[model samples]
Target: MVLCTCFFVPPLQAQESPEVDIGGALRFNYNLSSWKPEQKTRGGDFGYDLFRINANAAYKGIYLNAEYRWYSDGFGGGMLKQGWFGYHFSKNKELQVGLTQVPFGIQQYNSNNWFFNLTYYVGLEDDHDMGIKYIYTGEKTEYQLAFFKNAEELRFGNDSEISHSRYSYDVAGRNKEINQFNGKFIYKFGGNVLQRIGFSAQYGSLYNLDTEESGNHYGLALHYEASYKDWNLKAEAMNIAHNPENAASTPDDTILMAAYGAAYEVAADFNIYTLTLSRNVPVNWGPVSALQFYNDFGYMQKQEDDFEDSYMNVTGVLLTAGNIYTYIDYAAGYNHSWLGGNYIDDFSRGTPNANWEARFNINIGYYF
Candidate 1:
């Protein structure tokens, strides 16, 4: 027994220590919007936008990743963007637990602009929740399955009211999202030009606090992506339905969604389609290494009668220089939230005669 114990102790002592890395970013923004007439008269506005910290650590097969961010007061003051612990069973299989990104149409992002797309406004893109995820990567295919308990909760207990200070939009106000299941599958075609086709599905229960009853929501999407040389293209289409068991006084055709310290009503049933194209060009300009020019467009068609549709288009260029990155974008929208129209009515009832509004924005960031 003593000889066997001695042999096991040496192997344990030889194990490597954990590797840790910490980094952060500081960013500032300048923008001029046609919607804000007063700001347009003042030659637009420039201000601090975000400060963030990222930490990652790995020990053998276990790892952790987290990010915390501080935004301007108009946005959420401070929030946890993501935090998760993961275990790698092998090089191609892993599991993540905690506040992780929801497995949806696209993996990281569906758009390549500062302002994402109409899909993001409708809570379909880049949405994260409190969940556990399992990922499998094969030679020509990938799979992801997840179960989210809820969105990130700001406080403890059974409080019915959810806070609006968050990074991801979720069902708020009288309804909360619960018991969500997500599944995504992707097939890759390898050649000179890499191509991928994927499908995603989601189903969740909407627990109404006011009525003490549960409703349901579901979404389905199909997406395709391709890259050839310096050119890339992405396209996706999806349909979503939200049925909330609200109080008798509330409308059934709309639901409340909250993020960035604000709440707004969104159409309950809608179909969204998006397309993006980009080209990377190598440059020899001073301190600027490369430039990527992209255009992203999204359209939303509401299902209710007399409801106006929403659409957005963003044309942007990203400049990368060592640790400094800059994005210059010209974005235009019609009856879209974050672009123009009334706060709570834009995505719900909308204005039939709404004119196109445009904004010019520049964002600079230093990452380390």
Candidate 2:
């Protein structure tokens, strides 16, 4: 008994157990551009310096988990950005509450990767409207079931008091967009094999503030991913069906438009890629981006193409990018819409609008 106790005690003293790691970064950015929406509205031209900031916190636990992002851009209103609380059953599965981006369409990708979030990418509105989600991550398959408030009709304010939303709803029929209960589901199978298939759907009508439009709709996204050697083929067929009976006129309709794109890992540090053609859509701010006012703009070649020209060569909006302490969070790179022909949007139409001129951004994160 004494020999056994001594051996076990010595091993225990030499080894350390596992606990959770908790710390987050303060994403900072300083912009010198003309297109930063806030600057545009503030009477500052292309050269006035603008600064933005964001903060995050995480608790990686087995039973509980949460993440929030706060950023500011000087405009577009504050974002309730991402506020969700979940109870984990398995390490990769859980039940969630609060504003959650429904796991739909290329569920593996983040909200930023998609072309348009306004589409039924998730159960609609980037927030929670009496919603719930269930995620099951199996060894060979991953599944998601989400139910949240859908924009049934167009309403103004956040008058969700009747809908059990903790936030106040404004009467937004004429001035805002709202919807009814939106629901979605996605199932992904196959590992890092040669290919994988996934299916997703979103159903609801738009209603905010209060006027429920005459058109009610549902959206379907069929996604697939496969590789032939180093070449990866990723595609999606997204379709939306609208019921004309719900509307007064012909109910401006859209349908069967989807994703077709591919990526080829040319080497370890680079990849050749292309995506389907799509139009541009605008999105407002959230609680997080609002508070941080931060943006991230990567390296740019001074636009001074001519050998003799040198008067602020780069003139366009810049996406002041943020960085983590040890790794470049370039994956979660924030986006900004710059004016001039160098627009990030699919369509470069009317980008150099008004007096908006060329803009650029620089990051001096730690103001020491």
Candidate 3:
């Protein structure tokens, strides 16, 4: 979400203050979800969520950008989400360095749901990497090329869960990218109705702590998006493959062991598909301003034959008024995570005779 709070220096204080752009946002959420069998887990299904601060400035031809985030679960511990500095040679070209988002997938994604899609958790989309990047923007096309040194390896606490890296959420658990290369190209066409087609690719050598071996991770994706009237539609399909070195040598107690138990294989290749549709409606009521309705569906299938597919359906609504925003969503997953089994088509919810696992979630936030 883009939020900005502007400040103007008073005439009396203008001489003592420097002109700079700054803004930040505060977010609080009370979540109600069926996924929580016990309500007390993770702050009792509702609590303060996030606080973020952003600043951007440019002097001469050099520019700097930064963002810091604090999570409620961390007791308000600060995390440098993004910090980068670059030289703006021209309006359409620039080179950036530091910790930033890897430009391999769509920005803002294609979902209105706060949780995003499954690929996000898998580290294929909305993942950031510390790297150096060069970008080129033309009238009808934009291109990005980057070489990332690592795949987000910053840690804080000693606890494994709390100290885990953000960008290494793949199933294999070996997500420490020793080295990586990423590139994406987007081309736009059509006149009245804007249309865009894009391609993205990434390659990384992920380090495994158990065997101390590095695995190869690679993926390719094709996506399309169109905007018309109040409707925004998006679709993407991708193939992600992982090749772990010395898989048989891994001990039976690590994450690799669990991954082996789930897939019954050393290496895995999977195909994932995502589709999203959203519409905006103007509204006039008390504090209510505008409304957005959206639906996001995602499906994943193993490349191997006879492997079942997993899917999730998310439907949500967004309400925006001034700097305040609220989102309410209903999500259902079938044969998808551990809570709902690992495969598909069984219509079983991992339990003996259950159907599917469903949850309702809501988030409220305000920008300052």
Candidate with top lDDT is: 1
Residue pairs in candidate 1 whose N, alpha carbon or C atoms collide under 3 angstroms: none
lDDT of 1 at 326: 96
Q: List the candidates ranked by TM-score, beginning with the highest.
A: 1, 3, 2
Give lDDT for model 1: 0.89
Backbone N/Cα/C clashes per model: 0, 70, 0
Q: Which should have the higher lDDT, number 1 or number 2?
A: 1
lDDT of 3 at 181: 87
Best by TM-score: 1
Residues 244-344, model 2: lDDT tens digits: 23233322221111111111100001111112221122334331111121111221111122211101112122122223211111111112122333322
Each model's lDDT: 0.89, 0.34, 0.66
Scanning candidate 2 in windows of ten residues, the lowest lDDT window is 262-271
Q: List the residue pairs that clash in candidate 3.
A: none
Which stretches of candidate 3 lie above 4 Å from their native place?
1-19, 35-44, 74-78, 155-162, 165-175, 209-213, 251-267, 304-308, 338-354
Q: Which lDDT tens digits does candidate 1 get at residues 153-211?
A: 88755756778889888988989999999999999996989999999999999999888
Q: What RMSD, rounded to one decimal, does every model reach?
A: 5.3, 15.8, 8.0
Tell me the RMSD of model 3 versus the true structure: 8.0
Q: Rank the candidates by lDDT, best first.
A: 1, 3, 2
